[model samples]
Target chain A: MKWIPIILIVGLLAPFSLNTHAEEKSSEWVKVKGMVCEVCAYGIRKSLMKEPEVQDVEVRIKEHKVKIVYKDPKKSLDRVKLAQILEDAGYALEGEKP
Target chain B: MLRLGFFILALLGTSQISVAHPVIFKGGIELQGETQKKDSAFSTTYTFSPYWAVAAQYYEMREPSMSPLGRTFEASTVQINHLLKRWWNEGSQGNIYLGAGAGVFAPQGLPSEFLARGEVNADWESTTLYVAARYIYLHPDFSEDVDFKKLRVGFAPYVLEQEGLNSWFILEWRQMNTEKAEVTPLLRFFFRSVLFELGSSLDGDFKFNFMIHY
Candidate 1:
């Protein structure tokens, strides 16, 4: 019976720990020009995903923007690399979200 | 009527190469093919830069000849495509390209002749609307020269999400040299890096085309 309370306390604290860890992850939304179709978005996503630092990518065609999630919060993709990727995908990076 | 059908089929077979943009993303590769009765064309392209690409294409057409029999014409060419201009709008993009090449053209059982080709292509597209035009010229040393022109307009019935399948209804107009124009209504579908088109001309001829990017 005494072990029941210990188990409950650990279970309650695990959710908090996971939440704190998730908070450490980082994401950035960048503006990209000339994304007129889904094919354009696909190309950008395919190229960005090949980078080890990229965890996920979301494209907004109407807004001409892309949200990039990083695997490590402290280590982000450099601006030069980001520009090169977009250039290879036939797009121009217009900088980060305002 | 049969002669016209054969001519249209031959034109449609070679038309697929002009349907998509010639230049793709840097280091990208594309494969495209189209087929109809007695005619077919295939091409492979490599994009070395954002504005330049090289492609090799093979086209075959079986058409009626003056000798009471049909003759097959085959052409193979290596072409370089250049993106001359591009425009980016708020929700649309436009591009113009020029291409030139030299190859061999031969009719079955005939000596091959040197062939030279040139093309001008332009297009503008947004999420909901699309428009394009192209002109192609072919000159062979031993055969009559040929001119081909095409125009296309399309519209999407609904907006497609990033991960969803995209569909469009397109109408195409084509003319070969001084021949009568042919109109075709096409259904286009694209998912990710692959695209396919199915259509039938008003003359009851069928067409199918597909493209893949890697």
Candidate 2:
């Protein structure tokens, strides 16, 4: 009766309302050293993928940069910590974050 | 000959190709094949962890005159390698590896003997230059211990400096124990993650090596 229209309106609006708090993470590029071959790149990709906060990681061979996409802003993706990760994985950190 | 063929078949099992590379990352599969005038060898390597890898190989010598095994024989081996150390110098990346392996060597109509394998490798590479050396020692119950030495110097005339195709010119020297050494001039090309090399030994033996990783 009178309430049917109101119920339809709420249903249509509910789907849009729940997504308001969803956040996106930005991609960051980190420079790395000792990436002379694909083996080095594979090592980087494998290690980075293991981080629960990492969404996607790409290795740029020529530039020696790794593009990382984090899970969210709540998770910390400190550049220094990233340097340590790569260093431990056999890649040397050559320059500051680019 | 039949035993050799069966041994190779057992090694291949279901695979079509075989492997070689100085470096193998953890959790990768490598297939390798090597052929000489009268002998052929096939091998596979699996890197199980960041510091460990396991390899299996089957080798057959077709010519008894060329083989030191006293007769034509076939051998199968399984070896393990570990990454001992890796260092970066300026912009050049280098690594050193050491590993040991043991297997069984069987001569036709003869008892199978235990075989031992040992390897040491080092390599350094930049965008345009690559240098590497490797030593392998194999001692079988049936023959004199064999020592293999290899050295390679390569230069990339065209340094793409990006994720594309890079080409290199390589000169390689290989010696086995006191036998005559063979010099090879080679061309190496890398596209993405796969590397391929083609060369001819000075004695006119064609050689090819290919590598890839997941």
Candidate 3:
């Protein structure tokens, strides 16, 4: 009978923890060089979307930036892999912002 | 007779200007087609890397009454395109490409010949403006050599976001070896990975081209 109270409390807190984790799934903004046209944006978007961790991608040609949403927030952004993807897409990664 | 053959060959070999990029992003595939009055060309390219691509091209020139020996000149070549240089500027991009190919050239009712091609192209473009130039040389084993030079300038009416439909108006000038030059005004539109062009030369010859990348 005593264990039932602890079980009830843990169940009550589980949803809150899951919500916090979901909120932590953050988006990243990356500055890209040579992303000047729609075609260039398409290439970058297509390449980034191939990564398993990337959930969504948006490219802004005017600002030369790419916004990436990750499927798993706990996984850190691999800058080396990001740079390789940009290089393969015929662009260069200038910097990143949180 | 030889002079007439040369003239007929030159007439059949009209402008070969393609508005498509020869080398695309890594693992990209591009298909392009262009057609005019006397000539039509189709090509497929695969880009293994950002800096290099391989393509197979088929070109045909047709004129029945003008040629004494043949009605059509057909060439099928395998080409390699190298991105020699690229510049990523603040609001624009520029690129230079060099390409070469060799294949069989066959004229109807005549023995097949060896054909070789060399080309250089350069382009610079921003969201609002674009300029490009190209030169191509064709050498066949048993015929006079042919060359083409082309220049183009274009402007967009309004700037649109990446996902929006984009349109541009362009003017093209082409000069073939020892032949009269032609001027064309073209409309270009692109949505996503598909691009198409429509134009008519000042001489009233129709032009159509399309490109798709995947």
Candidate 4:
């Protein structure tokens, strides 16, 4: 039982440290094209809001672009799904390759 | 009056400095073809409309052939509409409006003294208020010396109307000393404020129109 205290302390501290690291994760900015008008932008914003990991969506009508920030970068988002959201909202997605 | 209108818009914009309005510049292009029992005609039209202000619309139409051998004619018209609109049920986001306007038309074959003009329209929106029924009166000639009598009714509903896409489906009936009817459905797409429209009229004619706003 001599090493029991040290092992328990390390086990507890490791999880706590990992929790801090997870909380410190920063989101990346994703740019989307063809986001024109408040109506179109609002639709995308609403659809993305359903994802718990999504933090915010900002659409610039003049530039026809959208900037999305997510809370967790590790969460895999389906690009095709996002593209479909845009298409249904009456916009053509661009700037995926370049 | 134009300056006063501009000033009012400026004040309205300033008052809502932190908020955004739904108003935006709009334009439309139309291609129409009509054929009676024996005569068929084709025409292209362009129009520009400002948001939240009275719109002065102009149209130039041409009849490539009016007779069996192809007698051609051209006509032009200008309309000024003073529109008053109201939006209701913010949650539903629907719109209803009643408006009246006047217009003047100069056709090739009609006496210039019998000028044509007058219009009234009422509209309702389900998802977006884009279509309406309009009644207009036109005198085929109005030169400065003669009084003319003509009236036309149109059931025009916009197929698509947003900041980016605008289209109209129009069916018209006329009683200008005669009874006639014309149906047309127009499809238009807008990109960068430019509009391209394709239309088919009941008279079994097809046409296209392209327009840009500067």
- Model 3, A1-98: lDDT tens digits are 99999999999999998877654546888888766677788888999888888999998887878999998887535788898888888888885321
- List per-prediction Cα lDDT, in the order shown: 0.77, 0.69, 0.79, 0.39
Ranking by lDDT: 3, 1, 2, 4
lDDT tens per residue, model 2, B1-214: 6445545543452111222343365466666666666566667677776567777767766777666544776667777877788766444677788878887777767887888878888888886788888887778886667666889898888645445777889998876667668788988877765777888988788877666555
- For model 4, the stretches where C-alpha displacement exceeds 4 angstroms are A1-98, B1-79, B91-111, B114-116, B126-130, B140-179, B185-188, B191-195, B209-214
DockQ ranking of the models: 3, 1, 2, 4
Per-residue lDDT tens digits for candidate 1, residues A3-64, read: 99999999999999887655454889888877877778878898899889899999988688
Clashing pairs in 1: none
Per-residue lDDT for B23-120 in model 3, tens only? 88899887777788867777778889989988777777776443323366777677899999988766777899999998777777788789899999
User: B203, model 1: CA deviation in Å?
Assistant: 0.6
Task: Work out the iRMS of candidate 1.
Answer: 1.7
Judged by DockQ cut-offs, the docking class of candidate 3 is: acceptable
Q: What is the per-residue lDDT of model 1 for residues B68-163, given as tens digits with 9 covering 90 to 100?
A: 124667667778999898776557878899999887777678788898988899999988899999997778788777666889999999875556
**Per-residue lDDT of A92 in model 3:** 80
Work out candidate 3's RMSD over C-alphas: 8.6
The 10-residue segment of model 3 chain B with minimum total lDDT is B6-15
For model 1 the local lDDT of residue B20 reads 77
Residue-wise C-alpha lDDT for candidate 2, range A1-98, written one tens digit per residue: 99999999999998778755443447777777777655567677877888888998887766777888887755746667777667655676666431
TM-score, A chain, model 1 = 0.70
Superior candidate under DockQ, 1 versus 4? 1
lDDT of 4 by residue, B1-214 (tens): 4323422333222210000112222232323333233332232222233223233333333333322113222223333443344332211222222222343433446532323455454443333223344444444443322111222222224322323443434333322223244454555454543445566656766645443322
Q: Which regions of candidate 1 fall more than 4 Å away from where they truly are?
A: A1-25, A95-98, B1-16, B65-71
